[model samples]
Target: MSYPRRRIIQTGGALAGATLAGCISVSDDSSDKNTSDDGSGDGKTAAGTAQLWHGRSKGPKKNLVTNVETFGSETNHSVKLSEISELEKKLENAIPAGKGPHLFQWAHDWIGEYQPAGLLSDQKENLSVDIDSTFTKAAAEAVQFNGEVLGLPWAAETVGLVYNKELVDKPPEMVEEMQSIMDEHHDPSNGKYGLSFPIDPYFISGYAQAFGGFYYDEGNDKLGLTNEKTLKGFRFVRDELAKYIPKDHAYDPQAAVFNEGNAPFAINGPWFLGSVRDSGVDVGVAPLPKPKGGTPKPYTTVKIWYFSKKMNQGGKNATAGRKFAEWHTTNTDILSTLAEEHGFIPVHKDLAGSDELPAATKAYSKSVKMGEPIPTHKHMSSVWDPLKSAFKKVVKGDQDAKPAFKQAEKTIKSNWQ
Candidate 1:
């Protein structure tokens, strides 16, 4: 049957859920029954209003609101877009309470956790095929959970190496090349350095990735940070990379130096594009530096629309949700506007070819293509804080790579408990 759509949000992170909840009550309302495998999708047509939930405000939220309203008017379906704080926790509770929204917006990372919790709806094969053909290769692969397409991708982002075009005619292609650029230009006493990226887990991830490592392996559903390549990446960061970067340069300082034209190169994401532009420095975006055996690839995060279990059950709501997802993702004008106005890149491949793309986005596309989808496994959430701490320790020369890595892995394992 169908639902009456509205928004539900809770403000606290702790208001989440556990497994073993009761089943969703299937409505017995026969008047709205439209179950006939209408090719609209699954053999059921729910009769209620579908709620689209999200936690964003400003541009991203505005895009969703307009799309939701447009979808409703065109199809005569009842869909409401609402904003809620701590949306992830609200979803955790509402799904079990059978008062959940029919759809929601979230990052690619959450798909792993959501799937295990039975919070998402699997797409029809036809829809999955459409997604594959429409979205970027990296983004198309990222939305899947155990071979199932879990969401419709909207925006995609990954870090890139930003360099002053005035200082360097061409960006470096490999780590060694980056080092040479450093060797020739880095001089801390003169208020100049080769690179200005931070030494945290997030920043080092691209370097680690260049060495053939990742935070999690989807195939095995396990952490990969302690692998040989990853360990080498850590050592490289502490040994070779850190020496070029001045000590105590956090993210803000890294951007500041780059913005002030004191830095010839810096590793950053599209989000930093505005700052570079505002600084009035001509900048060029390039892919992360490649390592010896592998190409550099940054960790990519995808923004998407996830269909809830209720909508996947097939019915008017499912049809409406699918319709809305397609409209929001495929409309070229909307996607172009979103990418140009916001820092994130649209997943649509055509946008990459459009002359209308934001300058930063057009330049950053090469880096985005070289990037890997950030892991979505729930276990990955445990790796960040502890690993970043371990990373900082190694950077400071206070710890060895082996023990630091072991401690971080152990801490993550503990977090899994």
Candidate 2:
């Protein structure tokens, strides 16, 4: 796998909009207060209380809470966990109502929105020295808005090609090789697809990157979905969808088919590793196959904990919250334990190489080394709707790649200004 050099593209329009939104201003509320007596004299209490809201429910939540207690003595601080979907709805109302939690976990994209609303604090200046370095550069960069870090990465994942080991002992490295293998073994009657991937815009954009396509030309404030290279990427996915994947399999339903052994190869992330294992199937993971001359670049997303600037209103828990965030991310014991139980790559550089991670997780960590973090601009949220519609049209064979991309570009550009 090849690693692409980091290209920092600062387009004029986006930055100007962010500046207008007041996301570029740095606040002066950096005072730290020590409270609570967990007996460590550090203000952490064996009975300190902190509330956390996340999207994970039931089994995933229980597993995470168990790991949290194992890594840090929760006897010092108790966590109040909430479902991620519910938190999203409640956070909008809660933050303004002064009912938000001390710490919250959210997607990297939320940083841009929350930071400007005065809901989150700048994490870089507030975090401890030792914990600061534990997070990976890409993970850390995602949570940063206008160059100020806002969150500590709890876990991170990138897209990759997962295959059924029994079907293809030696998976092909190139697209052509994969096509040939599919031609030989693909049996529609057996309900097997050579490959499967999401047709939705956010997920399919990764396929475009794999073929050297980009949605935004951040350098020029222009959309590039209509560029020839990008169209070619779309055409590649469209053609593959027609030739190998089943007609009934839409992007959303593809993963279930892959899990059922209906598809020998699929494009997914580390989150599905457990499901595949539980299905009693031997799975092999590899970096996404490269286009003729282009390498596959999966869209990478990072999960981070953000402290609310508004939460500081409580005045008493602010110091302890900062300390807990620092310890949760930087402590080797904490990160490693999370990595082992959650099956996610730890943000800390030291623990990135841990052998304690499951085999699939180690493979994912290796892949993350080659992945690029998604753009963090607030306008980024606007790109998904049009992109998904365009991809679905192409895959469903309703339109040609050229016309589909042109429509996508028009939609994206309409939102840009």
After aligning candidate 2 to the native by TM-score, how far in Å is the CA of 57 from where it should be?
6.8
TM-score: model 1 vs. ground truth: 0.70
**Residue 15 of model 1: what lDDT?**
20
TM agreement with the true structure for every prediction: 0.70, 0.80
**Quick one: best lDDT, which candidate?**
1
Model 1 misses residue 306 by how many Å?
Answer: 1.6
lDDT of 2 by residue, 22-59 (tens): 11112222322344333456654434445565555233
**Candidate 2 RMSD computed on C-alpha atoms after optimal superposition onto the true structure:** 8.9
- Residues 183-302 of candidate 1 have per-residue lDDT tens digits of 888989998888888666666777776778676676697776788888887887778788878777566667677889888898877656655776788887777777677776677678
TM-score of 2: 0.80
What is the RMSD of candidate 1? Answer: 8.2
